[model samples]
Target: MGQAGETPGRPDEAGLGARLVALGGLELGEFDAVPSGPAGASAPAGAPVVRTGEARKRGRRRTHLISAGVAVAVLGFFGTAAYLFVDVGGRSPSAAPPPPRKSYPAVSAPVAVGPQPVDQGVRTEDDLHLVCQNWYHPSAPRFRGDSPHPILISEDGGAEVDYRSTRTLNQAAFAGSSAQRRAWAPEPRRAQLVACLDLTGPGRPIRDCTSGSKVLPLVEGKYRLTVYEVSSHRKVVDRALTGADRACPFVILSSVGDTLFSAVKDRQLYDLLRERVEG
Candidate 1:
């Protein structure tokens, strides 16, 4: 049977062409029927192609999804890079400490000037002249007795200031010798001491240990010299000659003694005894 409303028989070939021409209003021999092959027949020409709405919508959705996926990939790539950078170098830098200030010393007080009268120590060697120019302090205020006291010199211990042979000792040792106070001095008492000083102190039993010094130091454990008025048994010079004085020169001691030792008592005892001996 025919698929359409035709009789179930092979159509006459010449008539078939004419029938299709009449139906389709085409020329009679425009289409010649070819024999059917094992490959089978194709669809008739000029068929209308219709598509479903769901299929079109599905295609559009797939395009939009692909575009969105690409955008998400770009965003995720930048996001991952930024996250890694922040994780690796997220901490802030620490600040450093400052340096210390510069340093220096403080200023000192000013120096003193003028003559220091207070007995500082012994005189120096530079001022050991024939006459002392800087006799800052004299043992006594002034000389008394209107008559000059010629010194009656005597000594117990000391290498210097000898009374035995001053003329020979001066020429031998102390001739041109330059020392502030020579431990071996042989100065002339009358010539050296042009004046006298009162060196009397609180009477104490003193030991004149004036050994091997230029001046007869009033130290303990040495010589003993006692002067008295011959006419009377009165002791005129009973005081010790342990020279520990810190006063100015007695004109004679300034020439012999220095900052360490002094002969003020030596000169004082000489004058006190000289008055009794000569008079």
Candidate 2:
């Protein structure tokens, strides 16, 4: 029973199909009383209706995917941040300030100095000439001979020699004792009998020079000595040729290595010295 404008409440033709529909708990002959017009919306023909449980299941799956994505993004952000912090912490303290740039002193060539000797424990003559040791310090009156000669020392303070009498004969070869040589080592090479230092030119002086020879003199007495500052053959040449006439024939050069000549206990230079004596 259906009206002209009314939909069916249930199908009139019923059979096994209706019984199967009933078993599924669905009323197959019944119609939903929904208004179908242009104003009211309805499902289009041949469209499937989704159940509330299936829609809920799809919504749950989408929510789970979104949550997993958020978790992965959060983990990536924290991991990157942690790596940066670790890298910064592992670095050394700002590279040690570049090692303080070495600063060196700027210098050119070395300077050249003249010939000079160090002044330590050096002695000087009465005239202020440099001497190496005392005449009577340890070894006095060094005399080398076949037999030891009784050392005859002068009565004066410094052993002065007479040039005129000492040079009359040849007595330059006789070397003194070891003790006497050591005592006279500080003073320049001098003659016990010779007098006067002749400075004539700029080469080696033609003095009575001796190295390894011996000579015998007829007479032995106190004689005038001429002391000269000698270093090498060249210096000896320069010294003998460059200075003015000295005050005494028996003279000694200044120990400062200067080209100056001076006199010691001379009868002319010192009024106190009547006669200079030497051993």
Candidate 3:
């Protein structure tokens, strides 16, 4: 059937019908009616359309990517935090213990000094005046029922000179046993006596003297004596005195001003002298 004015279907309509037939499983009747519109006003032909299934699949893939990125970031943050906690916590190798506090010895208080020795006699020799004193502690212990005595000699009105015994002569000479005597003998090549001489001028006194050596007359032997000069520190005399003269018993001979003075001691007289001097 044909309508005279419609012209047996428009060419555009025929093309649309042909396109509907070409589409797989689409019937021509389904798009047979087309709304009349300006050709340029409709959606552009052959543009790609997004299907629901493909859109949903793309959205899921995007969500999975975003979720994976977030998980990775979260894992990195937590891993870094855990690493920092372990490094900083407790006794790590990086953090060493404080060095042990330096331990110092305890300081002790100063000790108090006791009384000093007292001077006794004043004897004059030419231009030189001498003072000899005995120093002994009042409460000192007795030796063999006798008190111990130490002597101090001062020459030319100077400071006191202490004579240190090189060997334990005074005590050992009075020892009751022969074993003690052998033990108290002076060592070989060692000084037997030591005297500190203080020479006084108008200024400070000088204390510089070499040690002296003496062989006990009771024991026959050769010995050397050393003398020191104060004005000029020269070894003026290095002489040896050898003799076998037995003039005085219990005598301690000492040289003073080119003459030998004997410190004589007998048991009865010595007790009397000690009593008088000590008192």
Residue-wise C-alpha lDDT for candidate 2, range 3-75, written one tens digit per residue: 5755444443335345434444223322122223222245578644422434434544665677689999999
Q: Which lDDT values do the candidates have, in the order given?
A: 0.36, 0.31, 0.33
Model 2 spans with C-alpha error above 4 angstroms: 1-43, 46-51, 88-179, 182-279
Where does the lowest 10-residue lDDT sum fall in candidate 3?
A: 124-133
Q: Write the per-residue lDDT of candidate 3 for residues 75-103, one digit (tens) a residue.
A: 99999887787666755555668879999
Question: Per-residue alpha-carbon lDDT of model 1 for 1-279, expressed as tens digits?
Answer: 346633343456447545544544223223333322211334367633322345434544665677689999999999988777766666323323455767778778977653324243224222112112223323212222443322223332233443221211232234443431221241232222222122333333333333344444332222334442211222344444445454433343433443223333434443434453333
lDDT of 1 at 255: 30
Model 3, residue 190: what's the lDDT?
Answer: 20
Residue 26 lDDT in candidate 2: 27
Tell me, by lDDT, which candidate is best: 1
The better candidate by TM-score, 1 or 3, is 3
Which residue runs of candidate 3 sit more than 4 Å off their true CA positions? 1-49, 88-163, 167-279
TM-score of each: 0.19, 0.24, 0.24
Query: Considering lDDT, which of the candidate structures 1 and 3 is the better prediction for this target?
Result: 1
Ranking of candidates on lDDT, top first: 1, 3, 2
How do the candidates rank by TM-score, highest first? Answer: 2, 3, 1
